[model samples]
Structures are given as structure tokens and as C-alpha cells.
Target: MAQLAAARQGTHSTKTRAEVSGGGRKPYKQKGTGRARQGSIRAPQFTGGGVVHGPKPRDYSQRTPKKMKAGALRGALSDRAREGRIHVVSELVTGDVPSTKKAMAVISALSLEGKVLLVVGREETTSWLSLRNVPNTHVLSPDQLNTYDVLVSDQVLFTKAALETFTAGAPTGKSVKAVAAESEVEA
Candidate 1:
């Protein structure tokens, strides 16, 4: 199957430019000070040089083509799936809403232990509450998913919505648990 690109929205703006300061005036007077020929105090030589503080503020946001974005997301998901780090779920709904008990039950039912990264399709008050109390369950929306989180844990779980959001670019509409089940070899 064709997969998305491995890049994480890398269509960065090429317009970004660094701002430099200092180096305008001459420092200490030449000739007899017995020291170096002084130029601007901001000459980067004097302790107070122009901008020892570094560049000023600017935008870091990047723009990628729609096709690229979708492709990259798909690729990332596929790579993780191929590595056996991804798990797909039918849904994440629990009878007790977002109860810790319900969350624990799901974990136990699924036999998910250790650090689990749960990628939900959208936000949910219950999933937040339910998973929050769990020791190592990290919950986040599909949009927030990233490589760092993927690499941090041994596995990744995806709700059906999250999977769709990842593979098909769909918006999450309800609460669902997408869990990454850790292996016994690591435990």
C-alpha cells in the first residue's frame, strides 16, 4: 500500500530571516587607550554588544500543501503500524462515562499495562477524567499526536476516529480510547 511521507509538516516557510544588531558604531577610541581599537559598543566585543541577547521575535509557523500534509500523516501512521506500535479500536465509550473505574476496567479488559499513549479523535471530559487517574496513560487528541509521543512509549492505540483522523483526515466527534499496548518483553 502507498504510505504518507515521513516528514512532520515540514513545508516550512522559506521567508524566515534572522535579525542582527550591533556592529554600527566604533568601540573605544583607537590610538592611545592602550587597548584594542574600539568600535561600536554593540560590536559584539564589548560586554554589552548589540544583541548578545540574540535574534528578536518572529513567526515559526510553516505551511504545507494539503496533499503533503495528508500524505505525511498517513505515512507516519503506516510506519508506526508496520512497526507493530499501533493498535486500532472500534470505540472507547464506557458505561460509567469518564469514571476512573471505567478507565481502569478498559485497561484491564484490554490488558494494557505500563505507559500507554491513548490517541482520541477529539476531546472528551470523561476520557480526560478516566485516563487522568491512571498511572501511565497519556491522552491527547489526534491533532496533538507527534513522533515524540510515539517514540516515548512502546506502543500506540488509536480510536476508530483517531485512525480515521490519521489515515483519512476526518474530524473526531466523540470519546473513544485508542491505546498502545506495551509488551511483556519490556516489562
Candidate 2:
């Protein structure tokens, strides 16, 4: 089993070159084809290149068995718990459009200072309106959960509903199976 890494506790996993794609075979032949001596069809000089099968748009998804996902989630949560980097509240009640004041109050109540990624079972326009203006604070749903976002934020606030939703794939819930330890920057 892969060591469960947590963004909060300084443990993070990065994708290996294999996970990326490209390098499959040689480009063209070294003989007289009037064209530049190539190696295989996969050469980078061509439309594609002599790279092993370069990164394709396939699923970069890692196969973490059901238990692993659960374990990883638990491990991540446990890491946060150990560091007290998580704040779980019963609900994330915001006004119709999400008043920043209310959102600020929530942070104040939780005493969650610094960058925070507030996770909910689902994103709401109100919360969006409220937290969007904040520099480091951002809201996300379970499905939108990813390693980078979790890592960027100093803390993760999971509402009870969101936690339940993450644990169970319900009609309204989504899964956050990716390792939550990456930066938001696109790979």
C-alpha cells in the first residue's frame, strides 16, 4: 500500500514520468528517404514525435481500491486532525447570494486564520458570492476536490453534510478519490 500522504502534514506524492505519456518508438529510418533520418514513427519531429506514447488525454486516474480511497481519505483527515488543521461544522449556512460577512463570521467562529479551502457536499451560489472575494478562501464540492486545492489551502473545513457525502456516493454526493496533496497549478 502506498503511504498515505497528507498535504497538511508535509507528505505529498507527485506523478512519476510513467504517469505522463509520450515515448513509444523510434521516428524515421536512418536510410535515404529524402527526409531527415528518423528512428520510429513516434518521433517528436513528426506531428507527434519519437516520444514513447506522450501524455494522452486518457484517465490520469490512479487505481486506489475502494478501501484505499477510504483509507487515504481517513489518513488525510487524520493528518489534519492531528495538526488541528480541520474545522468541521454542522452546516455552512450563507445568505441567498452568500454574504461575505457571514462567511467571514464562520471563519471567525472557527478561528480559521490563513488560507483555507472550505469543502461542502455541494457548492452554493451564496457561499460562492461570500467567499469568492477572499484572497485565499475558496469553496468546493466533493467532486471538485483535488490534491492541489487541498494542499494550497492551509485548512479544510468539511461540513457534516459534505463529510457524509464524501464517505458515501449518494444521489447528491460525489467522490474525491484523488490524492489531496497538490497545488492548483495545472500539470
Candidate 3:
């Protein structure tokens, strides 16, 4: 939940009476007026008045411990793997630019449905762009992988290079060499 909460964009804002303009003069006399007292036209009671106790812009981000975050990510991935939803593709070859047709062919070949999270290695722009136009598909580098995305995705597809990078030094008990060798065989 922390990760999901932090992902929210807290851009809401509301102006207070002090922040509202054109309220310098008193709306009415203090004693003569039978109406309720109001210091400025920008008071909450006025039609165009500033909001009272309304939302304010703030940062929703929260800091999670590095170990905790890693643990959560590992747990999520482990669950997906246990459920047989994780796929390791030998490669994600794409042309110089985005190609929705190629992406569709890959998806169909893998029989992936629902939301698919594609993990790629650094500087894999062609592969990333290729999957951009594919609906329900999202591309991210190994560094950008998070527990939320892993859990939410119905299928997690990792390129050979990305799988190696993602599993490097991870506590999954699978050595980088083993993963690389497997990917090599697949290639």
C-alpha cells in the first residue's frame, strides 16, 4: 500500500481567504450591519470566496527502507513465478522505432493476456517503444521494476538481458550465471 500511495500525484490545491485576491477592504461595517460579521469578501460564506478546510497540494510520497522494498519486490515476483505467470523471453528484438504489429505478434506468440509488464535492460529503447502502443502492456527497465507493477500485472515478461540484470545479487537463490545460461539455451 505504501508504494501505491506514494505513486499518487497529490496535485490538489485550494485557496484560503488570505491567499485570495481583492479582499483587502472589509465587506461590511463591523457594528452597523445586521448581517453576520465577515472580514473580507473572500470569506468562505461568499459565493466566490476561497475554500475552507479544502485540500492542499502535498507530497504523498513515503520513504520505505531499502531492504523492505527489496523484500516486497522479491515476494511479489516469487508469487508470480509460483503461479506460473512469469515468462522469460530469449530476446525482445524490435526495429529502430515503435512497431505495434511486432508487439502484437510477440504477445500472441506468448499467449499473454490482461496486463503485461515487460522488463528490459538499459538503453533498450527500440523494444520499449515497440511495446508502447500495445494496449495493457507497460515497459520498464530493471531498475524501474516495483512490487506494485509486478503484483498488478497478469503476466511479467522479462527479456534475457533484463532477467539477468534484475536477478543479479537478488536473494532468489538463482545465480546470474544460471539465468544467463538458460537464456542462452533459449536464444
Candidate 4:
């Protein structure tokens, strides 16, 4: 949550009375008129004046433990699952080529609406291309899934291969050589 908050653009800013333009000197004398005395024309009570106690540009981030970030992601996934917004498919057919039409058909068949987060395997480039063109749909590999995307999306669709690989857990620092060696043992 801290990281997500920091990533947001905090450009909201409002000038104070001092920062407002055209407030060079006092607008009127202190004991001149029978009416109330006046200070600068840019005071908060005046029209076209600076806002009082308004928002300002500032960082909205806090340091978080590594475990806490992981827990947040877990929480988001569980929430989506609890809401019954997760769907799984064995595979998507775009014929021998990437077809956007086929992707729309699949979405309509599943009765999915709103922004859809489609997760497929890294090897399924065609599947990714096919669905990426659909309106309000985003395609990503299982490894690219994150808390922000999961939380923002209304529906989460996972291909069977991607679901299995993602459920296996994130990859550690092990290199391809180490992983391959593990798969092949000595005689």
C-alpha cells in the first residue's frame, strides 16, 4: 500500500495568500473609512484569492516491511476470489493467428464485463496479442500480476497454464542453470 501510494502522482497544489499574485501592498488604510479595515487583496475572504487550508504537493508514502507488501498482494487475491470475480480457462483459440474477434467472442461467452485482467503464460504470445486489443482489457503474463492491477480490475481471468505457474510462487534468485540442473540428476 505504501508503494502504491507513493507511485501516485501528487501534483495537487493550492497557493497560500502570500503566494498569490497581485498582492503587492495594503488594499486600503487602517483607520480611513467607516467600514472595516483591509489588508491584502489576495486574502482568503476576497474573490480570486488563494485558497485557505487547501491541498498541497507532498509525498504520501511510508516505509513498509517486505512481508507486508507480500501480504497485501495475498489479501487482494483473496478478496477477488471471495467476490467470485476470478475465472479460469483451459486455453484461448485465436486459430493459427492472433484474432481480436475471437478474443471478444470468448469474453462475451464468459459474460465478463468492465475492465478485465487477463493472465496467460509467457509462452502464449498469440493469446496475449489477441486479447490486448479488446476494449477495457489488459493482458499480462502470470509473472507480471501485481496487487495494483488485481485490485483495480473488475474481473480476473487466468489461463490454466498461467494459473498453475502463478500458484507455484514467485521465482527466487536461482538461475536457469541451477533450475535445469535440479530437473536433471547425476547418474
Could you give the candidate ranking by lDDT, starting with the highest? 3, 4, 2, 1
Better of 2 and 3 by TM-score: 3
* Model 4 CA lDDT for position 12: 98
Top-TM-score structure, candidate number = 3
Residue 24 deviation, candidate 3, in Å?
A: 3.4
Q: What TM-score fits each model?
A: 0.53, 0.51, 0.75, 0.63
lDDT of 1 by residue, 33-147 (tens): 7886765555555454444554444444556455554445555555666776566676666554667776566666777656788877665556666676567778888777755
Writing each residue's lDDT as its tens digit, candidate 3 over 1-187 gives: 8877887899999899888878889878898778888888888889878899999989888887776777777677767776778888766765577676776787789898899999988777778777777779889988788888988899989887888786664546542311222322232
User: What residue runs in model 2 are displaced by over 4 Å at the alpha carbon?
Assistant: 1-71, 170-187
Error of 2 at 164 (Å): 2.2
Q: Any runs in candidate 1 off by more than 4 Å, and if so which?
A: 1-43, 90-93, 121-124, 133-135, 142-152, 160-168, 171-187
Clashing residue pairs, candidate 3?
A: none
**Model 2 lDDT on a 0 to 1 scale:** 0.60
lDDT per residue for candidate 4 within 77-160, as digits (tens), equals 777777878888878764569887777788789999899999899988879788876778888887777778888899888887
